[model samples]
Target chain A: TQLLEQSPQFLSIQEGENLTVYCNSSSVFSSLQWYRQEPGEGPVLLVTVVTGGEVKKLKRLTFQFGDARKDSSLHITAAQTGDTGLYLCAGGRGKIIFGKGTRLHILP
Target chain B: GAGVSQSPSNKVTEKGKDVELRCDPISGHTALYWYRQSLGQGLEFLIYFQGNSAPDKSGLPSDRFSAERTGGSVSTLTIQRTQQEDSAVYLCASSPRGGGLTITEAFFGQGTRLTVV
Candidate 1:
């Protein structure tokens, strides 16, 4: 089975702080996706990185795919309370296999 | 684009009762999927539907869980004899295509949170 492991299961940060969450696996993936979900709602897609060593940015959020396609990271700079949510990383076939999410709380 | 949509934002039921969840995918989407998000288990894939055909049912935890898509747009997941362990958010997603079986970015719906007592 392909498994994706996320680190620091939970994180609490104050506004304006910067933080990074990780997703690692022993298996390589063709594509990896990052999602953020608020309480009581489904996850919303953030970005998809297909190639190794690829980097994509959305405003204050930065996503990086590993050189081996076996890991990925999400970095949020100058974080705000609105950034608080459960962050998930899904690997393998870009279809199934979502990692145990990193639950984030940004305090105002 | 209308996005994906699910019905009955929340469901509460007694043990042993059966329940069905619905999903209306985005127009022209050819791929549909079902997933579960429980407290400890995180997100678990349940099934996948391509048009009216299901090529993967590998994720269903038990035979009690079943799903189907008809007319190439709407899908339903039925869970029989509910149990407390089944309480979780049932999520539905759709993608335009997966040309080589590797999916693209999926659009999700507001999941139906099921609470089995």
Candidate 2:
């Protein structure tokens, strides 16, 4: 069984602060994806990183895939109230597995 | 549909009863997935379907939980003898395809919130 472990399960920070969350696993994946989910809605895909050491940026968010494809990180810069939500990292090709997720609360 | 669509945005059921949730994937998408999510938590994968055939059912919590996709377009998840622990937002997603080394984007539905009382 492959499991993705997420660190800092809960994070609360003030506006304009920066934070990084991690997702780690022992199994290698063909691709990794980051998703953001707001209340009452399903997760929305933020980015997909397929290559080892690959990095993708979406506005204030930066996502990195580990060189071994066994880990990933999501860094938020100058996070605002709008950035408050659950961030999840998933890895796989056919049957993607998700991390428990980091619930972020950005204070206004 | 323009995006993945799930029916009965909210469902409240009595314990021991059965319920069925529906999903309509985006046209032409060959891969459909079902997941369950508790409030403020990550997704718990339930099953994966590739063109009307379920290739992975390992995520299904138990025999009480079952799902099927038809015509490679829509899927239905059925839960029998529902329990309180089954209450959660059931989410459905679809990608253009699955497997192989290539990466694909998955589009998700708003999800069906199930409440077992």
Candidate 3:
């Protein structure tokens, strides 16, 4: 079984604080995807990185795929309260094996 | 466009009872998947369907868990003799096309949360 491990299971930061979440796996994946899920809702896809060492940005959020395609990261700059939620990195076949997840809490 | 949809957003059932979950994929989508997410855990893949038949059912946790798709659109996941361990949010997703283990942009439904007593 392929497993993805995410660090900092829970994070609480003040508005304007910056943070980064990590997702690592021992298996290679065809692509990696980032998703943000709010309470009581299904996960919403944020971005997908297919090429190794690729990086994509969405407004204040930046996502990067590892050179080996076995790890990924999400960086948020000057986070806002609205950014609070669970951040998950899915890898492997891109069919998606999710990590334990990082639940972000941005305080105003 | 209409997103994927599921019925019985929340279900509370007794142990040893049976429950069926429904999923309606996006129009024209040829691939559908089923997943389970226990509270505070990541999604656990349950099954994969391409068109009307399941090409991958290895993810099913046990023989009690089975799924089928008909007319290549609507799919049903049936759990027999439900147990407390079966309690979780059941998520359904569909990609525009079958990626065959490759990841594609999959649209997800609201998911059905099942609670076993």
Which predicted model would earn the best TM-score? 2
Model 2, position A63, has a per-residue lDDT of 90
Q: CA lDDT, every prediction?
A: 0.89, 0.91, 0.89
- By summed lDDT, the worst window of 10 consecutive residues in model 1 chain B runs over B97-106
Going through the candidates in order, their DockQ values are 0.57, 0.76, 0.55
**Model 2 CAPRI quality:** medium
User: What digit string (tens of lDDT, one per residue) describes model 2 on residues B1-101?
Assistant: 59999998999999999999999999999999999998777889999998999989999999999999998898999999999999999999999999767
lDDT of 2 at A39: 85
Predicted structure with the largest DockQ when compared to the true one: 2
What are the clashing pairs of model 2?
none
Return the TM-scores of chain A for each candidate in numbered order: 0.97, 0.96, 0.96
Clashes of 1: 0
**What tier of docking accuracy does candidate 3 attain?**
medium
Candidate topping lDDT: 2
Q: Could you give candidate 2's per-residue lDDT for residues A1-108 as a string of tens digits? A: 879999999999999999999999999887888888888777888998889999998999899999998999999999999999988888776777789999999999
Cα lDDT of model 1 by residue, B1-117, tens digit:
588999889999999999999999999998888999886446898888878888888999999999999999999999999999999999999988753535487888999999999
Worst 10 residues of 1 chain A by lDDT: A90-99
Q: Fraction of the real A/B interface contacts present in each candidate? A: 0.59, 0.76, 0.49
Which candidate model has the greater DockQ, 2 or 3?
2
